[model samples]
Target: MKTQVAIIGAGPAGLFLGHLLKAEGIDCVVIERQTPDHVLSRIRAGVLEQVTVGLMERLGLDARLKAEGLVEGGFNLADGERLIRIDCQGLTGKTVVVYGQTEITRDLMEAAPSRGLEVIYGVGDVAVHDIESDAPYVTWTKDGSAGRIDARFIIGCDGFHGPSRKAIPASAAREFERVYPFGWLGILADVPPCHDELIYANHERGFALASMRSHTRSRYYIDVPLTEKVEDWSDDRLWDELAIRLGPDAAANMTRGPALEKSIAPLRSYVFEPMRHGSLLLCGDAAHIVPPTGAKGLNLAASDVHYACEALAGWFKRNDADAVAGYSERALARVWKSERFSWSLTKLMHRFPEDGPFERKMQVAELEYIASSVAAQAAIAENYVGLPV
Candidate 1:
């Protein structure tokens, strides 16, 4: 097979890239290691920044999102007794929507075949070859049969564990990472949300979040040790802890049913420098990852792909490689900003048992300042609504 661009991974990064490129009259093929059902059913991030919503609107992908998504004007920072509202609409003149990642994948996949795009599923042994040559290729196996695809350029959107990032030479890339001592035990319950907007609570026990997926279903998370396992947590114990951390005041009016899903995600910050090499470019989790504190993971992924699409379009239309050459630097500016915001939010909300008394006191002071000062509130509101794409 041959095409102008061969994109690895069918997740948001790769799928959205293919969609944008096709709209620009660029021919591309997308390859995925998972079936369509798997990609559509996998539960992931749900928050959408205003910039992301505008992008989707321009692409004609907002009909279902607008119908099914819940729009919120702001979020609240609470400490059981005290509540401070950060009005996203008032501060930034923008609002956020709560829509599942799975829904976006479903919409993109449904639109792929109509665009004359090829998506190969259940593939194996995906690899990038001849990166230094003019004709870099992606080779893979489908249904026990091997095949090769040659393209003028290739993109690795296969995520952090895939072969995309590994193909880059270690000497040419600078890797930076930090792992937190705590992780979030997230739960999906078959109950209505307790609050109208997301509540980020800081308590002496730990950090807790009150969020929802829909009117009938809710999502919640509590900070726990990195070593804790989901199996060790029972439904009663989970609700009990949630009640304590989210505050007994709010929990009193809230009702919860059996948990539909539960998982633990470790907190980490990772970035790979120089997200491009020769004919291959990387985007999304393949290039960087931020803690979920600021809800930047999905939004950042969308932003990176938007930049990449513009760069690729310039290269194809004007034969100008300048945009392509500057892709890494351009994406990194936003990536680092997001990293800083996520880290700051995590540090303020989560309790670190390893921290000394001074550090712990400092964290409390920061939280108090954010709640009391309008300037500090505005800073958080701006980043939370999202920085410019």
Candidate 2:
């Protein structure tokens, strides 16, 4: 197969990139290691920043999202007994949409086939070759048969665990990483959300979050040790920890149900400098990953695709590689900013045993300042709701 661009991975980044490029009259192909059903059902991030919502709307994918997604004016930050709400709309003049990542993946997958785009799923032995040559190709096997796809450019939208990043020469890359001692044990329940808005709770025990996926389905997470296993947690134990962390008032609003799913995601901050190399470029999780605290993962991935689309489109139009040339530096600028925000949020909300009494007091003072000061509130509001696209 031959095309203008070959996108590896059918996750949000690759699928969205293909859709955007197709809209711009660019020919492209997308390949994924997982089946369409799996891609559509894989649950991850849900919160959509204002810029992400706008991008989806502009791309004509908002019809279903607007109908099914829950719009929140802002979120609440609670420190045990006290709570403060940061109005996203009031501060940033924008509201966030809470729709599951699965929904967006399903929508994009369903839309792709009709647009004359090809998406090969359940493929194996995927590899990128000839990056230095004019013709970069993706080689893989489908149905026990080997295949080759040649394209003018290849995009490594395959996420963190994907091979795209590994294909790059180590000498050409600079990796920055920080793994936290804690992880989040996230749960999907059949019960309704305890609160109207998302709540971030800071307690002596740990951090707890009350968020929702839909009206009837709620998602919640509690900070746990990185070494802890899901098997070690029973429903009663989970509820007990959640109740303690969420405090008495918030616990009253929460009613536990049969957990639909549960998983532990380690908290970490990582960034790979220069997201592009030769004819192959990386975007989204393939390039960087941020902790879930700031709710920037999905939004940052979308931003990466938007910037990459512009660069690819420019390359097609002017035949100048300037946009592609600067893709790394440009994307890294925003990526680092998001990294800082996510890190800051994680530090503020999670308890650390390493902290002294003074440090613990400082954390309380910071929370108090954010709750009492308009300026501090606005800063958190802007980061939480989103920055301009």
Worst 10 residues of 2 by lDDT: 380-389
Error in Å for residue 7 of model 1: 0.6
- Per-candidate TM equals 0.98, 0.98
Evaluate all candidate structures by whole-model CA lDDT and list the values in order: 0.88, 0.89
Q: Per-residue lDDT for 51-117 in model 2, tens only?
A: 6887688678889999999999999888988778998789878788899888888888888888777
Candidate 1: residue pairs that collide: none
Model 1, total clashes = 0
Q: For candidate 1, what is the TM-score? A: 0.98
- Lowest-sum lDDT 10-residue window in model 1: 50-59
Cα lDDT of candidate 1 equals 0.88
Residue 156 CA displacement from its true place in model 2, Å:
0.6
Error of 1 at 145 (Å): 0.6
